[model samples]
Target: MSERLLHLGHEVVALVRPEAAEVVGAYEGRIGDLLDPRTLTAAVTPDIDAVIDVATPLGDQAADAAAIAALTAPLVGTGRGFVYTSGVWVLGATEDRTADEQSPVDAIEIVRYRPAIERQVLALADEAVRATVIRPGLIYGHGGGIPALLVDLARKFGAPRIVGDLGVRWPMVYIEDLAELYVRVVTNASAGTLWHGVAHPAVAVKDLAAAAGAVAGVTTEPVVWPVTEAADELGAPFAAALALDQSVSGAAARDQLGWRPDGPNPIVEMLDGSYR
Candidate 1:
């Protein structure tokens, strides 16, 4: 996202760990930790044109709330944009419905606070800040995120295992496509709007498992792991999220900001492209 914003000729000031400061290449960066309210405040200085939070809250509820508030407080009344990163899990299992920005939330434990955080972000518009919520789907690309786990499992155990049955699916967006959407929202979106960052509304977990199997020279059949067992192997909340059947579209991003997601979908790419 920082790179894309820089590509659009915007001067980006990224908040990264002290060790990561050298890695942003040409962009200016503030060395800080997201978990610390003081560091977050140090990063969101008055000179910043916009603040994009891509960090996940990493502490207890009170600390997370405090950190989030510290991050959002500096932008109030200043009118500088605040782009809060949330995810599709906040909308929970969509069943047969294709969720949009206005959909009701039934979040898993990991992201239960996101709905409230998003509401707070939107309400910041009342303070004259152009606040927006970016609810990205399962972000996968460059040999990382959840699909990488499938790749690893396929290599080690032949058939890749999915958390649930073949019917389960997840909304997906390639990293580049998601980055472009972020740029669009930063430059063009109106205040108080929420945008879904999904490209393909849904992709079957079995299909991704098959992609992993293809890379490993194994059969495409998937083994369904029990959710409870998965919870132990992973975490309860993360396992539940993996098993969720979510489908969502980036229609609001498309219609509102003329954003187009041209990056390759994860299923095919995981099989034949970068994964190799």
Candidate 2:
């Protein structure tokens, strides 16, 4: 996102953890933890035109909310914007249905906390600051995302395993495409608006695996690993994610912000090595 913002002629101030220096680089970054309110306030000032919160980990939602509240307090009545990044995973799993901004968030116990934070951020629209929340689908790109992990496993093990029917569809977007949505929301999106950042139509998990396998020069077949066994092997969190049947729509973003994603479809990119 920082990279894209820089390319868009915005003066970017990236707030990053000190340990992420190599990953974040020297693009006007402020090394600090998002959990610290004072640190966050110091990193963000009322002078900037907008504040974009892209911090992660659901545990940090409270702190992020607090920080955004603090930052916007002074910007209120001044017409500055605040763009907060959230995820579609907060919608949780559903049976053969696609979720949009208005969908009921019947999330699992693990991510049920997101709706409150979403509400808090949206409430800021009542204030003078323009606040927008973006819910991105599974972010993939640059050979550094989920598909890449599968490709690496395929290359090492010569075959990748799909846990279940392997027919579940998952929404996704390239990192660059997601970044473009963020930039658009910050610069031009309306107050209290929610946007989805998915690019292509939902792709089946098995097809995604096959695409990854082709990129890695290997073959793959569904192994039908039990959910419990997969969780035990891959750790509980990742296993739960694998079990989810999720897809999201980006119609609102396209319609509202005039944002268009021209990036490669994630599965095709994985197969063609263009993602790498």
Candidate 3:
């Protein structure tokens, strides 16, 4: 999305490691490390217009909070925008209902730290910061994120392995559409607002994996793996997340920010386009 923001004519200043300095073509890139507090603090200097926190920490919850506080503390009270990237996993198991921004959130164990950080992020509005949160559904594309696991395993073993019985509902969004939402938030959203970056909010996992199989030109049936074994292979935290049945409402984003994701649903694009 940083790249999209740059294309939209925003002067994007990105932090990068020394080895990656060549990757950032323009926009005043800087040499910095995510693990170093000084690097992040220095990067969010007063001259910067906004600070977007898309970089997530490792499994340490405390470390995550500390990293966020370090990055955002410098931006508070500046009335500058602070866009925090959150996820729908924070609204765990929304199977019976389509959760909106106002819906009560009970995050799964994997992302329990998110809700608190979300509250802290939104509270920045009170401190004169134009803070907003975007909770994206399963983000798939660019040969990365969660679906890469499916594609990788499928390539190796014939089909993508299912985490559970393939009955779980997985809300999804195409990567490009997700980038568009970020650009929308940067261009038009109000402070303290929350938006769901969802395209198809309740795509069945079976269909999702089937689409992934098609990406690899494989027609193999999805083999259901026991939750414990999935956890062992994909890690407990991530497997626990995959086991959730979630659906979210993108109406708030569409209505407020005029977000129109003019792209194919993730399943279609994954099967016939980018995922290949």
Better of 2 and 3 by lDDT: 3
Residue 150 of model 3: what lDDT?
A: 77
Q: Which of the two candidates, 1 or 3, achieves a greater TM-score against the reference?
A: 1
Model 1, span 106-131: residue lDDT tens: 88888877788778778889998888
Per-residue CA lDDT of candidate 3, range 1-276, in tens? 878887778888877788988888766888777667677787788888787778764567666667777777787878888888899999988867899999999998888888988898898889888899999988877777777777777777798677877788887888889999988886778889888999888888887777777776779888777789888777887888888887788888888888888777767767776778
lDDT of 3: 0.81
Better of 1 and 2 by lDDT: 1
Off by over 4 Å in 3: none
Error of 1 at 201 (Å): 0.5
Best by lDDT: 1
Q: After superposing candidate 1 on the true structure, give the runs of residues whose Cα lies further than 4 Å from its correct spot.
A: none
Residue pairs clashing in model 3 are none
* Candidate 2 stretches greater than 4 Å from native: 19-26, 58-64, 156-158
Report the poorest 10 consecutive residues by lDDT, candidate 1.
Answer: 56-65
